[model samples]
Target chain A: MAGTDKQQDMLAEGPAIILVEPQLGENIGMVARAMANFGLAELRLVAPRDGWPNEKARASASRADHVIDAATVYETPSEAVADLNFVLATTARPRDNFKPVRGPVEAASDLRSRFAGGQKTGIMFGRERWGLTNEEVALADEIVTFPVNPAFASLNIAQAVLLMSYEWIKTGDQAVTPPEQALAPAQKLHIESLMGYLDNVLDERGYFRTEDKKPKMMENLRALFTRPGFTVEELAVLRGVLTSLEKFSPRNPRGSGAPER
Target chain B: MAGTDKQQDMLAEGPAIILVEPQLGENIGMVARAMANFGLAELRLVAPRDGWPNEKARASASRADHVIDAATVYETPSEAVADLNFVLATTARPRDNFKPVRGPVEAASDLRSRFAGGQKTGIMFGRERWGLTNEEVALADEIVTFPVNPAFASLNIAQAVLLMSYEWIKTGDQAVTPPEQALAPAQKLHIESLMGYLDNVLDERGYFRTEDKKPKMMENLRALFTRPGFTVEELAVLRGVLTSLEKFSPRNPRGSGAPER
Candidate 1:
């Protein structure tokens, strides 16, 4: 009750990650962490082999206590998924059930659509050793399998959960934000000044000996500098590099102008 | 020289997964398992804190023995990626460097293109605690970050490896295969016979006494049985379900023909 930030529950309204007869407490812990990594908070357990409030699981969660603490346990898979309108059963071996088979990416999109339609969704994972039985697989609406190497198609419970969870979050229109806390990009004025200094320095060093070809070379140089749109700090670093190189120049001093000089 | 079946390497050719100064052998082992799940084989380590040939990592890798057995180690990030023509560094924190940032999907596309051109590529992951140093990140071409929950952005070594491996595998033009070795579908003639039997049973039970509605009801029943394309085994299972349901039907007895009777 102390961590009653209930708003988090609704905001992170990701699909419930259901583990049916999960064997290890450590695996449960990792599953919880994987869910947290993708902003999924709801967790359900159907007859866990190890009882709840497991200390090992808590330790393994690596601080995803929100998912661990709020986890609900059920006596059966049907009860675990009773509230879900859209359920996906994850399996490695192909099933004979003839249910629509989907990959994790497609399943993510499906879950997102269902969630938007005000439907509660969940994913069911079976036991560690074997996997979901035919009866258990029948509880879900569809089967979602990974496109793994046929020779080595086995994925540990946590890794499987992470793959699905990773896609679930990826389905959202979350644009990739550029690096945060990064320096602002340098203005065109700053880039032009840096380019002028570099041109003067390069000309002084007789680097443009082929007279006619120098125009295209200068164009290429300008493209390279303008392309990256260096940040303010980066422009300074470039100036520093130029200054350090000029220090070794016995022919010219550290003066900013060279071609004009 | 012993395992010179290099063609397997080319067919399963994937970008190298580099761990820089990873601390634990167990973590490295899980990383191998994660990579193998997506059919990635190349693994490079830069000065693993626990050293190579670690028994803990070997056991932790589950059964990804090929990846573990062939894993290469280097003294530094540079040496580790020396043979690679392109590289992408993964990070959670935003760096001040003015490099172009990409999400995992874009990074996977980039890797695929480089791989197509016969150019080797690798992805660099930083240490567990702090992550790739600014200096180490400078070694790569660009940064690829996950669109994870900002509230909890920390992904353990194996989870990070899994996300990248998953995206890499998804970028390929792989199509989803249907379930494996399922029973042969019950013929359409069989479905018609089953439907006709059901109609007689329902009529005998006085379920279609509403004469005008009986045709529509029978049509719906036919559609239901025909929709699933149940296999021979599945058709038998359905008959079993019907038999069990009929046992409770006090009035009607089990008979071969349906509405005909």
Candidate 2:
């Protein structure tokens, strides 16, 4: 029952994933799995090193064989993306010739909106050994790149695909709430307000003096307060302590700093 | 030279390294090395199974003997933290009565500010075999926990110290500019401008129909743009494309968008 619905969903509103000169069948399969993760099913293979319909590719695809089965084979990248009104080429390295580059999140959001507007979009990923050639990148309307650690920028094709797909899925499903963990809405707000009150009190005490240093100081304070995810009642108790301190301080002659403490 | 400065710094504002009954001397030395990696030099031994000042620890410390040299021996956890105004106990398992837990980033920020204000702050980490006892955790003002994969939370002492040190160094040196790599600054601004232009064009075209949804859409777009850190020139070119699109569209009869293009 899930399989049928998945296939139907794949047929509708899915972007075409074009792999350019992919080397390994394992990578191809992994890419298929990644595409499936974000509800993308249409895979277009453009000139592979390991032949299409290979068992290795199918095995690597795991449960995402539906995407592999539904894939379209293409002789060239241009052919694969010919029908696409919008094409985004993925690369880690920057191009010498300037082109509009968007991060995964922005590109995903744009693609989601465009897809909803009846625009056919194709996101192209390069091979493992070397990324997309200069000529190949020039063919796309826009470039897409992932923000990765510079020291270890070389990403396995599947990981790149997964990150991109995750962002795309997030942008596409705006209403779907992410998995709920410990932090909730009320707790978050209460924490923020508590931090705000603390900041105000600290500022009055001249704790953070340097003008240039204020932003960092406040950020450090906020980071400390927000991390705990305090409840409303917990915050109220903290505020009471602050009020008691203000009242007890001998400097406050008129009790302007004091509350009902 | 480095060793002497490290020792002096440790004496001045050294972070209290509480090892809760750590078994191995090699692990302690590795922790010292990891601490030195981020300017943390203070070493506190809390009821270690192995005797203090072990040769194996000195060997592992390598050039970071300053940490091992200034190490303070403690028979109990309470004695180790008696001088500290704020004490944070690190653990993987959550306790019901434990003070609210925070991630490393928040904990580091809190420690930095507290230390700056002349408050003695100590962060207690658990041993390899068995972590900090619930009774030990109850003595802490806060609990510090790393966000690790739940299935595999068993981190080596040195690795845990390294992670915490990384966060501490980042928070402590908040004003220090990160080392610049390739990808020119101009390109970054260009990317920003291009994103702005695209958003404006989309807005003018009524692409964002719902007023309520506009802020969220814009925020998502901003997140997408900012994540990759684009150059100004890149942003400018992106904006040019948006301008061209706005000019060519049927709704906007004028060619005003061509100016930037």
Candidate 3:
């Protein structure tokens, strides 16, 4: 409650990530982290080997406590997905069933459309080692598989969830903002002013050596400075540095551009 | 070599994955697994904390041995990606720099298009504790980030790699076949014939009791059966079940739908 500022719970309405007999607490924690990273909230655990309220899982979750805290535990996969209208069981290998198989993107798209239609949809992930059994795969409406290397297609539980969650976030309408503490980019005029000031200081330092090549050299210098595109804060910092250098000239103390000391 | 057959290396020519001072062997292994899952081959390490050839890493990698085996080590970030024409640094937080910022999808598309133009492209991932230094990020042509939940945006190293690798695979022209060993769907006529046979059997068994509601009930049952669009295998299985049920009739020896036992 202290760290988490709840704002209508943007992650409340996505597909449930039901982990069936997940082995390691660390993997579960990592899965929760991945889910949180992609704004997926609902987490259902079916018969975890190490039991519930796992300390190791909470520790590894790294402040994704919301996912862990709100997690629901069930005894079987059927019970885990009982409330959902549609379920997708994720498996690496193909099963001997006729269920439609979807890649992550297509599955996510389906999940988005289904969620929009008020359908309670969930995606089930199997265990770390053996993956989902054919019987377990039969319970789902469809199967989801990662197009992994056929020779060695064993993906850890968290990795599989991450792929699905990433696609879900990408294809869904959630707005995930990159964490930022920086200022907005400066206007073009502000950047040009910074460049003009720097050019004046460089000229005073005789940085433009050849008279005939001065314009081209100045143009190249300007191009180089502006190549990466300066932000407002960055331009301000550059201006501060240039002003500092300008103060170093004794005769032109305030950067008057007088030929001096 | 026994398990992994070389097939002109579909993963060889894509973007490089440069890890800068990655801390854990488990994370490295997971990263390799994520890369292999998406067919990204090139891995460059910049001074890993536990050093390379780590047994823990190899063990955790599952069978992404090629990613770990062909991994290259360097002393610095610049040295790690020195051969690349373009580099994108991954970060959770925005840095005070002038580099262009792109989300994973946009970045992967750029990587794909740039690699198509014969330019070697790479993406840099930072350490576990602290991300890439500002100087390290400055060396990159652009910054790539996961559009993650700002409230708790700390994604583990492997999750970052998986998202990027997934995008790379999505935007690239690699043949990623889902492991499907099933038959094509049956014809509409076949399904209709099966349905008619089953209807006759059910009718003899008095499954449709009320005459007034019989048509609506039959229509609903037909819709339910047809909704999933059964494949040939599924239809065959259904037909076998129907025939087995028919054999229970007493009046007919070979399930002729004559009621009486």
Please give the CA lDDT of all the candidate structures: 0.76, 0.66, 0.74
For model 1, residues B1-261, the per-residue Cα lDDT tens digits are: 123245434335689999999999999999988887787888898998888889999899887778888898899776787666567889996676656789998888767765655657789998999898766775666788898877766698788988899888887773423323544345444555576678877888999889988866775565456445465578778888885676644355455335222
Interface RMSD, per-candidate values to 1 decimal: 2.7, 11.6, 2.7
Error of 2 at B67 (Å): 23
Between candidates 1 and 3, which one is better according to TM-score? 1
Please give, for residues B1-261, the per-residue lDDT of candidate 3 as tens digits: 223447515554588899999999988998888888788878898999999888888887877888888888999875776556567889997665656679887788867766665667788999998898765775566789887765557787888898888788777654433423433334344545665786787888798897777665665554455445456678788887767556654446564665344
Please estimate how well model 3 matches the true structure, expressed as its whole-model Cα lDDT.
Answer: 0.74
Query: Which residue pairs come into collision in candidate 3?
Result: A186-A232
List ranges where model 3 is wrong by over 4 Å: A1-8, A174-261, B1-10, B174-261
Better of 2 and 3 by TM-score: 3
Compose the digit string of candidate 1's lDDT tens values, residues A1-261: 234266444436778999999999999999988888888988899998989979999899988888898899999876787666557889986676656789888889878865665557789998999988776776566789997766567798888898898899887884433333544345445655676787788888888887887765665565556445366688899898877786645566556446223
Which CAPRI category fits model 3? acceptable
The number of the candidate with the highest TM-score is 1
Name the candidate, 1 or 3, with the larger lDDT value: 1
Measured against the true structure, the TM-scores of the candidates, in listed sequence, are 0.65, 0.38, 0.63
lDDT of 3 by residue, A144-213 (tens): 8887744456678888887888888777664433423443334335545665686777787798886777
DockQ, Cα level, model 3: 0.26
What is each candidate's DockQ, to 2 decimals? 0.28, 0.01, 0.26
